[model samples]
Target: MRCQPPSTFQVYIWLKSKQSCLLCDETTDATFPICTGCETDLPWLGDQCERCALPMPMAGLTCGQCLRHPPAFSEVVVPWRYDFPIDSLVTRFKHQGKWPMGRLLAELLGQSLHYRFAEGLPRPDCLLPVPLARKRLRQRGYNQAAMLARWLGTHVNIPTDERLLLRVLETPAQQGLDAKARKQNLRKAFALADGARIKDRHFAVVDDVLTTGATAHALARLLMDAGACRVDVYCLARTPKPED
Candidate 1:
């Protein structure tokens, strides 16, 4: 006699026994570290701008700022809003050099991009992790964006080109700066590596968080100037604009 397939309940029990929630340490039947409950509790972005992924009042509507001044990138793919536990987690991962936290976040973001691709989002030709300044890389010991990009690229089967974009300037930290100041700070900050070839290519810049989008804009402009036909931003989180 042929063996029968396992029931859904059996699979669920198996998963629950094998995995535990990252946030609460509860037994879970999910693949990722965070359980379904904690994932639902995440600051997931909803009804966001099609161009920039900024949270908006309604879905499929462009934000007023993008309408007024278009961004350099064609579109942004962000999985979460920068808030609460996510902010805390990103801080610990990015600043504290917590590799486990960074890996978990990148895995979740990769899953989000996979779903988006299933839902008709076009996969870019390549992924470019926004380069960190030499000074910052030396200080941090690793580039957080590069790590995220490698993880995401491996999961999604996209080529990650870390050498295409170069950070030529070591600017001050972007925290506490207004949009104008941020833009000014990023000006002349990025450059293309010598002998890089990107004509007619579509690329996505991967990062951990997008606040003010100054860095994305600067990098996208550099890529375009270097013959990239389309540039997109793929970030784990997008922060809302601060009120005046």
Candidate 2:
């Protein structure tokens, strides 16, 4: 006799048994690798800048910096603060080729986007992964932001166009740079890919993290110059500015 396929419950059990939480290494019933408890314990962004998503003391208002000199992007959405295990996970994913960790983070970010969309956050016409310079792509073997964008696109049903944005300059990494320096370093770093057409469309630039927002701003400016009507930013985590 021919064998039969397993029931849905049996398949669920099999998947649950095969998955373990990335943080605690405990087996989880959820489809994602992170357990519910560990997910809840991650450093979620609290009161933040309405425009830049920078962690702040107040919510539902734009920070002074944004009000003084607005970023090119109209809005920023990040689910986590740059802290603790989230930072460690981002490091492993970006520098160590730890793809599983990236997937976990992307899933969480997707969930945040889903809820935001339900709560009246505007969905973009397309998603653009912040492009990596060719040299950096070669060095890293893959672009972590592109990977996250693909995963998020699949989860959230948004179309992603990787070829629309190009990282034309191989500038030094943004780490250790102050906000002003970061902006200057990326001034002419991004460009539109040839034949790209985003006229009157809304798009979100996707990245693994938002630090000084320099890179995102550069890309957003490029997109706006390319005739995109609106540009938003989506990232896994946001780094708060240091106090003077």
Best TM-score goes to which candidate?
A: 2
Which 10 consecutive positions of candidate 2 have the poorest summed lDDT?
8-17
For candidate 2, write residues 1-244 as lDDT tens digits: 7377655435333423557888999988787888889988999999999999988887787888898989999999899999998999999999999999999899888988999999999999999999988988999999998999999999999999988888787899889999999999988888887888889999999999898888988888888887889999999999888762
lDDT of each: 0.88, 0.89
lDDT of 1 by residue, 1-244 (tens): 7487656435333423457776789887777777888999999999898999888888989988889989889999988999978898888989998887788889998998899899988899999998988998999999999999999999899999999898888899899999999999988988888988888899999999998888999888888877889999998899987871
The superposed Cα distance between candidate 1 and the true structure at residue 35, in angstroms, equals 1.1
* Top-lDDT structure, candidate number: 2
Off by over 4 Å in 1: 1-17
Q: What is the TM-score of each predicted model, taking all chains together? A: 0.90, 0.91
How good is model 2 by TM-score?
A: 0.91
Off by over 4 Å in 2: 1-18
lDDT of 2: 0.89
lDDT of 2 at 174: 87
Clashing pairs in 1: none
